[model samples]
Target: MYGIYIYNSKNRNITIGTKEEKKFSLDIYQIYTHDPLEELLNEFREGQFSTTLTSKQKHMLLKMVRKNRPAFAIDEEPLGKIRGHDIELYLDVEIPYPPMLRRPPYPESLESRKESEKHINELLEMDVIRKIRHKEIV
Candidate 1:
């Protein structure tokens, strides 16, 4: 149900669904082999993928020999010469984390301290306060 679709540039064709059950679809979009390759490489360089390559993805094309990889290249032969459906290439790329989910700056500012104190005071007045501990770092 959840899978990527890859277009076969050699014959101006496209395949949808999983690798095993790849069904031929219309080739409305032009296939750009180099663009996807470059984007994947850029993502790898940015450390967006998992630390362990094998765990993240079952297959991957090495950077040095990317051209040799069938998924990254398109055959120059005529459409009639090619047989069977083209291979589907899945990039080892991950969706980036939301900006708000990242760590915030340390050392609260004066305005931040005031706002926090006001909120805490309101909570205390509402009798919703739990155990509180204050410590001063040396």
Candidate 2:
């Protein structure tokens, strides 16, 4: 996807509810695309953006997708997870009893059932899901 952003710089001290702010700058322009482009020229022309792109410029943008393809998510060697040691997740709940152990059900349709089974198998293969010995968490 192609994106464009424009900013207008203004300085002001803090108060509530006015255009001026110390926290953020004014957003003048923003453009982004997530879908396949059928006709590049017509799509770019339709928006209410302050600026416009020529057909040649639009064509050049699409070339980025062909020239630079991303590595798949399955390629975990380069993109290891970003779990910071300083941060932790905490769950706060006031429950009367323990959390329920529920295996509600998978979809009944044949295709859905097959997809569900495939997902389980993939997780098992990846070790994303695994067996572990558990004790009471007093």
Candidate 3:
């Protein structure tokens, strides 16, 4: 006889007639939801998810799996849990952008400009810089 059984706790020993079977098992955790994709999409559409995420996160979910970042918990509340009647979902939500990566400071010092000019000159000498010039009509 073949059978599949789910136990609330870990079970190690099973006795059948004169034979005793011992098996080591680990806990199986899963996220359950009636409509996981739809729910995740709804949450994203409503702007209920975080935006912070690394390139890895984007590559994993968005590029690899073709799923939106907000749809998964990786870009928002990662440890958040959503409970349903039949299923429980675990999320690792993350914010989309890091504060530091946004709104970079503008260069305000002449020294900075000089350093940039030096670099540009070096690139130009190496023929690695292409200058686009517009002619003025007199």
Candidate 4:
């Protein structure tokens, strides 16, 4: 494959490509010098967010993020916990009894089902979701 190179210097902005498809050039050599994934991860960890907002707008956004920091997940972590967050909902519609709704099981291959079960078990272990036995439900 042709190797593409971009040069952005003080006086010039040029893109150069190697002629030979199979020949490995400096452009191709530089490609493997750094991992793009790792660079992106590092940027995320460093909080290097790029935005077109003005300085004042950016400050306001930063303040909001800092204030609601617990609500956002970092590094695949679960959402932030809000202390004393007991919620109650009052519906206008009245029902004689609790409604029971059930859906058919999703169609999945054996391998896919096993994978899903493994992931769900991991989430349960991590306390991301509660496991309720049939008897526990009213």
Q: What lDDT does each candidate get?
A: 0.53, 0.48, 0.50, 0.59
lDDT of 4 by residue, 1-138 (tens): 445554554433333456433333232323456754455445446676566766566556666766777666665656554546646666665555345323556699999999999989877765556788879942
lDDT of 1 by residue, 64-103 (tens): 4343443332233112222254456564544575665466
Best by lDDT: 4
Candidate with more favorable, higher TM-score: 2 or 3: 2
lDDT of 2 by residue, 19-129 (tens): 343233444356765545445435444433225876565577645533442321324433323223334445464545344634454448988889988877767665445
Write down the TM-score for model 1: 0.20
Summed backbone clashes in each candidate are 0, 0, 16, 0
Model 3 misses residue 126 by how many Å? Answer: 0.4
Supply the TM-score for candidate 3. Answer: 0.21
Q: Against the true structure, what is each candidate's TM-score?
A: 0.20, 0.26, 0.21, 0.40
Q: Candidate 3 residues 1-138, lDDT tens each?
A: 434343455544333333434333554466675864555455446444347865455334434333334334543344233334234455444556566656777866898889988878766654444476668421
Give the residue spans of candidate 2 off by over 4 A: 1-90, 97-107, 131-138
> Among all windows of ten consecutive residues in candidate 1, which has the lowest summed lDDT?
73-82
What candidate 3 gets wrong by more than 4 Å, as runs, is 1-105, 134-138
